[model samples]
Target: MEMAPMTKRDKILLYVVLMLSFIVLYIRFLLIPGIENVQQAKADLTEAQDAQTAMQETILMASVNAADKNTTWGDLQNANAVYYSLLSSDELDTLVTGLELNHNMDPVSLSIGEAGTQNLTGYAAGDNAGQTAAPAGSTAAATDADTDAVTADTVGTTAAGNAILQQILAADLIPQYDQASYFRTSDVTFSCSGDDSDFFALLDDLADNYPSVQLQNFSISTRSYAAADGASVTGNVYNVTLRVVLCDKGGVQP
Candidate 1:
């Protein structure tokens, strides 16, 4: 027997099923994957932009820090040059003379000893506290009585003083003392008579202008004066003796 042909209703049902299958395949294989690919591209682009921004920020910060470091280093060099510049015997004398004249300190006397290797232990022991050894080939020195008097006047017996001395000892002074080979050590003793203000002003000048000078010992006493007309002066006069250690950066050993 022969098969019969399909009617219009069956044909329309078969066509509708095929169209539905096509729609499903397009959504699964083409449209959904395309949508996912677009999302992934967007994520990668965002990540790259973030990384670029971070790199730019890093570069900018590094440049700024370099500039700051260079400026700081330059400033330090300038300060060192001013404070640590070497001085010869003549230069030291000139500096002392200038200080005397600038402060109007009368009866100023300065004695500069020859350069020598600094004795760290002896210095800390108060061996060179109030006196400077005479220049080479000279046996002269401050009297032992004067040294004792200065020590008694300046370095009193106090707990605080002892603690400070201990701290100085613990500060690794030897290495710091020997760090530079160019250091030329000298002991300078100077005495002056002036008002109290003059003494402090002179100290401030030394501190601000000369960083390598260390005050070892000092003594201050009141001195009475009589005018030429046989009348007593109204104000007090201070006689000050100071022993200082001067370290020059570059100078002749003598």
Candidate 2:
């Protein structure tokens, strides 16, 4: 078959088809990939912006709480580290002995106990610390007998109450009350003998200086006693006994 003459219309039509193929190739290989890259970059930028915003908010919140943060740092100094260290028997004895020796006072008695255990009355070493000579008269003897009877009854009642209190205090009714954040409150029975001046000094030390020690109850009695060094010389004496509650409010733990 003889080939037909090539026509301009056919040439233009072939050129248009070639151009269309090139456009499709460009979109598939380059333009479409560029568009996808742009979309990916937008997503990454959004993520970065969200992270920056969150960090800024955290910084602002921390700045607002700066004063409380500083206060918490300062309170760390007063916090107790030992779990119930101040309530221990040895610690109480050490505190008492140190105070007594420093003031040159005779410790009549000292006891460390938890909330409700019965404490025995402690007396000083000398016989005179516990008792003095009785008056030699029938009337005095009769009066003494009556007083003794009353004392016996009072002691019996006290014993019964102490037993009940101990039972109540020993139970773990509320577990949270024993946590370090709460105060560890305990009882201390203390006694010491001194002159008026010495007694005042003792009070000043305990009242002004002793930390975490609170006086719950105290009684002071006066008497005359011969000085230990001087047999003939006598001095004014005051017997001081007190019950105190000790607390560690510092969240101290062992």
- Compared with the true structure, the alpha-carbon lDDT of candidate 2 equals 0.48
Clashes of 2: 2
Index of the highest-TM-score prediction:
2
Candidate-wise lDDT, in order = 0.51, 0.48
All predictions: root-mean-square deviation over Cα? 18.1, 18.3
lDDT of 2 by residue, 1-254 (tens): 99898799999999999999999999999999999999999999999999999999989898667876565434322222211233566766776667776887876567776643222221243222333111112112111211111111122111122222222223321242343223344566666666667767876766544423445556676554455564543444444444433334344322
RMSD of 1: 18.1
What tens digits encode model 1's per-residue C-alpha lDDT throughout 96-213? Answer: 6677668767544678877565432223444344322212221221222221111111321221222222232234332343423333466677766667788788776654444335
Model 2 clashing residue pairs (backbone): 80-252, 83-254
